[model samples]
Target chain A: MHTFADPLRYASRMAPTKTAVIDGNESIDFAELHRRCRLLAGGLLALGLDKGDRVAILASNGQR
Target chain B: MGVPAAGLVVVPLNTRHAVTELKYALEDSQTKVLLIDRDPGELADCVNHVILIPDAYDAMLSAAQERELGVDVRESDLAGLFYTGGTTGKSRGVMLSHRNLIANAFHYMTTVPQREDDLMLVMAPLFHAAGSNGVIANISGHWEPRSHWPRSIPRSHSI
Candidate 1:
């Protein structure tokens, strides 16, 4: 049983350098991914969106 | 509604579709913002704020050093609007909530031991449950998500 609200954090602290994500041509370590998630979440928040506000992303699934 | 839709309402769109069809969905849903894989100017009839996923999205990620949204989500909030095939000639909207998605995701996670090294490939478009859920679940599990299938897989193997 994991003991954290953000399981991602658990992984990060457990293995910061472990390769976490491999998207076809690129890969990101857990530490790197955590940073990206935070940054993107920040960008979303900067767009004047509140917690429950709807924000639609139409990307076809690469890494955006 | 699934992990991606938790705490938010997502409307999936077909990337292969004509702009006119996309416009109708946008209008019907009153979508505040529309994100597109490509150019949105292909559809001229309707107008709304459009954000095109840029080539630099990855570059931005590489340089990302900030964090914001926490994982806390309410079970009762509206999560997503899944439109059905519309047997009656009009597409129907299926509303899903955060709890619905979280339950499903937890169930899925328990069933599969998605490895930290494994890359989850989303073969379908990013609109449906499989694509959306897989993407977010992969993120939560710390697994890499392959955007393009055969092309991406081979590249990963090479590395």
Candidate 2:
């Protein structure tokens, strides 16, 4: 659908080893990030979250 | 990453907001879940779930299977809701769709492209839309190593 998620959807295959984000002392590669995000989505769904549901995030600008 | 991919709307609350402001956002957005890095305090009572980072969040992800984000999500679907700083009277929620984010990312990339060896240092808090301006270019071309999973990264962390 060419949304913001599209890049991540194909990231694992496009450049898995490429570095995506670097936080203080933490370096995350594409593969791990993608897997985690997908799992996160599922986890939220497992918790009974539905489409169009709202998920709020309140935290500093670190690599969460 | 997950929410937008799965057609859910992500509400990035301003970290600078007070308890009442935070509660108002939660109530107004009808946030079903709250993913926090610090203690939510009373904010925990506002959402259906309060997932603390690096612990409850990791557990939740590991127990669940990978989600199929593209199966139902469309470009026009609302991806995120960025709240204003409230300097202009009442804080408002800026509705941004997948298309909007992707386009913005492309604009950022076109203006300031990231090279293979160039790494982007994220300094802005993600609650601000400008902080996540480089997501598309930063993550679009990466390939997975087909290795272990991560317990720290959020759906929209950094990228």
lDDT of 1: 0.55
**Tens digits of per-residue lDDT for model 1 on B1-159?**
222322335677656545555766666666655556676674423434455567545544445446443455555666676665555775655676655554455545555667656766678666777766665566555432233112311222222
Q: Give the alpha carbon lDDT tens digit for every residue of A3-41 in model 2.
A: 655677577667788777787888887777777788888
Off by over 4 Å in 1: A1-15, B1-8, B42-48, B56-67, B71-73, B113-117, B141-159
lDDT for every model? 0.55, 0.77
For DockQ, the strongest prediction is: 2
Model 2 quality (TM-score): 0.87
Candidate 2 on B1-159: residue-level lDDT in tens? 567887789999888899989998899888999999999999988889999986988788879998866667888989998888889787888899987886676556545745677877776767788887665546653332222113232333243
- Provide i-RMS per model in Å: 5.2, 2.2
DockQ of 2: 0.64
